[model samples]
Target: MTVKVTARGAERWKQGHPWIYRSDVAEEPDKTPGIVQAFDRKGKFLGQALYSPKSEIRLRLLSRGNERIDDFWWSDRILVAARRRNGITATAWRVVHAEGDALPSLVIDKYGPFVVAQLLSAGLESVRRDVLEAIKYALEPEGILLRNDSAVRRHEGLASEVVLAHGQVPQVVEIVEDGVKYLAAPWSGQKTGAFLDQRENRNLIGHQTKTGGRALDLFTYHGSFALHLARNAKEVLAVDQSAEALARGAENAKLNGISNIKWMEANAFDLLRELERRREQFDTIVLDPPAFAKTKANLERAVAGYKEINLRAMKILAPGGMLFTSSCSYHVNRDVFNAMLADAARDSGRRIQFVAATGASSDHPELLNVPETGYLKGMLLRAIG
Candidate 1:
């Protein structure tokens, strides 16, 4: 079972990194795809690893040493990780039983009383029964859905499939955030149909709000940011190109019986430019956009896109206002991302001080050496006059 780690691969594994590149594989599995046994050159058992001849990452280490790979062990690890994220459940949460969470190739989102997962790798697909049983046993939620529709599936030579893993999920699940309510779909919406990672970000916005303030939430999918501010700010405006999202945002307002939130279904780029042209300004401006670049290949153009929007966004910020901005793209590292924000500040002729910035919840542990694993980044800035 020992998959000989070619010369340099042993060094990386010894250094605490978990991946072994394709070039480092000195042997090929007799099987084309799925989980396989791994070992050192001396035939010493290393662990089970997900193997893909197609991926640059030839091996994804699932376990090391004597650990056995089975449903019980899998479920135990998943439940322990989810229980540790007790705070995340307050706002739809990432049950991060995914590769990034050390459950490589599987990502789960807990929306309200429901849970959804995506089997992104072929190896995980082969072990689908093990993961499903683990999820059901670990978190007895109202429902569970398997949404394996991500593009990553094709890369692993697996077809996308969406099915009910357990229970029934309603179209809209109500979530309370900082004492405000929002409804998100667990089965049919965006990634897990809600942005749980931004729950803390929303709370930060509410805490930083000024009395009688006006706010703008760009790329405001479902109004989590705007609604949180609505409770404290004088007015809130949520903007997104997706009418469906805007409609849902409005529904969230209605669900909470709050009427001060305005929904804007406009091109985000044009909308920001229009705000700048009209000299319209808000006391608090939130710039939470989707991942402009998923891969490093698109990083340069993505930076330009971020710089343009942020610079314009900075232009309309009132003195003493706060700007909450974020990029969930793994390619945009914190240092590189922060520099772009600084560029926008300079271009817009605004002096801003960063109040706070952070990434995913502790449940979403970042393997120290794997930079690509920790993707979500956010910052709070005080816009100076």
Candidate 2:
């Protein structure tokens, strides 16, 4: 079946943005969720797209021309995404980054011999078999696990589930990233069992860490940054709200044979305030908090939260110290994030230098045309006075 869209939607596709909201769709197909040809009001063929009736995003363009979106087509796309990570020295990385890879609403992350995938749309779920086959053909992985428990699926009228789509998937899979060995929990861990997007940023912080200095990693989920900092820092404090996550971080520290990391379970915001009150200081600090703004409605609150933590961090940072801060909230754009940091720096009464700006790893490519695909943005700073 073919779907018809308004001129706005047609123009959006022409401009390289793949999503067409429901308000822009003129005619809906009679069929259920699946692939459908998209046409403009005057019957001009726009492209082929995945159609989801229940989702606000009515169409996600897959191709500009008429082409069969079969297993072979998917295999070619998957191969393209995989090829982009050729030089990455990590055993675990994102194979397909949803809209970033032009495969909207689909995410596939590789963890050693196993692969974890999330089909986050009704249309993508309808073609699950084809995607699974393509993944097998491209990666030749030992197993495939569907981590389809994301809340986004609820918007598409789909049930949340975790099914082993192919062979066996172990609960814990060990992966190496930039010479740091750690474990990924594909079955119950966060975001496909690990935070692979920050792989490169972690390495950068590790390399910038001063030897024999003290380091603090707030919101240290699994202690990825702390483990890296511990390699050089004389002592490192890794804090998180989840005790279970801290337990896993301890295991990771043990896996890497690093003894300088101290895993602590505490509220990161409160701890930051307490550390500042006590006049405590650290030579290096990392602020990698969870997304404070999940939507546009919460952006104000998110900015406040970011400012509080960042201001507190700057207050306790030792002179000539390094600070690595980041925000994964897409609603908080780079400009807003930087402005917030500038406010924090001014309010903290510290002379700070912007050392460098950072972004997601190469494996998680951000399409220039799609701003939503570029959610992760960060900065490296140094306290000069």
Candidate 3:
């Protein structure tokens, strides 16, 4: 292990920058990938690393302290972070959240007894052995799946592949969040079969779904919102573009022996407008769309999408109805999301009484400096026209 950081990179390290780019290096040739080492500009000790010359993130700073970046430290930190999460007993949750957990560009999602580990950077992928060993020892999950399917892999010059590392993952995973049971299909579904980050948001907004309320859920992927709300609401109308998604929503509803849910496959934008045109109204509306715009460059269009959906939701909202709107785009901050919601409220000619502002589950910790981890944002607002 040998390397040196750029002249002022040590300053960045001091300030808790979770990543070390290739430009940050000043010396030392790293022949092998995933090798942990320490270096400084003037031959002084800086910190240890999980090194990868192929990655833009060259080094995952394992420790700023003098401790080695070995199995003991990795296992300890991973468990410490995992223990902080609230409701991950026998279900899936983000056990290790990459940079937020100080293991840069690596995400470990525990799905039921199995775990899905994603190496989003070449540097972290370099330390596969240590990472896998840590999970095996600390978490002791049944199976470990390497879900390296993120777009970040392309940027790092790595190919996408999914493989079962040690054990086998079930096609279906049953998880209970806030007493709300969910059966997730990991094989042909969205990210590891569930949006675990929205667990807190889903549970929080359930209080608003009173009995006999007509609830409309747009982009209701897998019925997390629509199905859960049906427990209390009179009827739950879930809309999405994919028929497969709608079918799964229906299947999930049946799996829970639930009724009073309408799984509709349609463009949510057009459906919302149609509902407004027909003067149809819902007691509650939820907008949990996919990431419209991934990067900051397309933030304007993403904001437009949010504003449009939110505005339509407000239009069809019954008088004194609640609107639970959310955006998963990290580029769209809370301030911007709030601004978009306010604009939607004004467009609907309704006074927006904001009840609560919420974020992702506690398991997905948000580092103040790393804004990307603080992506999911939601607001519970009631419209009084």
Top candidate (lDDT): 2
* Runs in model 2 lying further than 4 Å from the true structure: none
Regions of candidate 1 where Cα sits further than 4 Å from its true position: 42-44, 87-91
lDDT of 3 by residue, 85-135 (tens): 755653668888887888777788877778888888766776688888998
Q: List CA RMSD, all candidates.
A: 1.9, 0.9, 1.9
Residues 221-307, candidate 1, lDDT per residue (tens digit)?
A: 888888888887889888999998888889888988878888988988998889898999899888889999988899999999999
Q: Is candidate 1 or candidate 3 better by lDDT?
A: 3
Q: Model 2, 205-242: lDDT tens per residue?
A: 99989899999999998999998999899999999999
- Please list the residue runs of candidate 3 whose C-alpha ends up more than 4 Å from where it truly belongs after superposition: 36-38, 86-90
Candidate-wise lDDT, in order: 0.80, 0.93, 0.81
Residue 365 in candidate 2 has what lDDT? Answer: 85
Question: Would you list the clashing residue pairs of candidate 1?
Answer: 98-106, 99-104
Measured by TM-score, how close is model 3 to the native structure? 0.94
Better of 1 and 2 by lDDT: 2
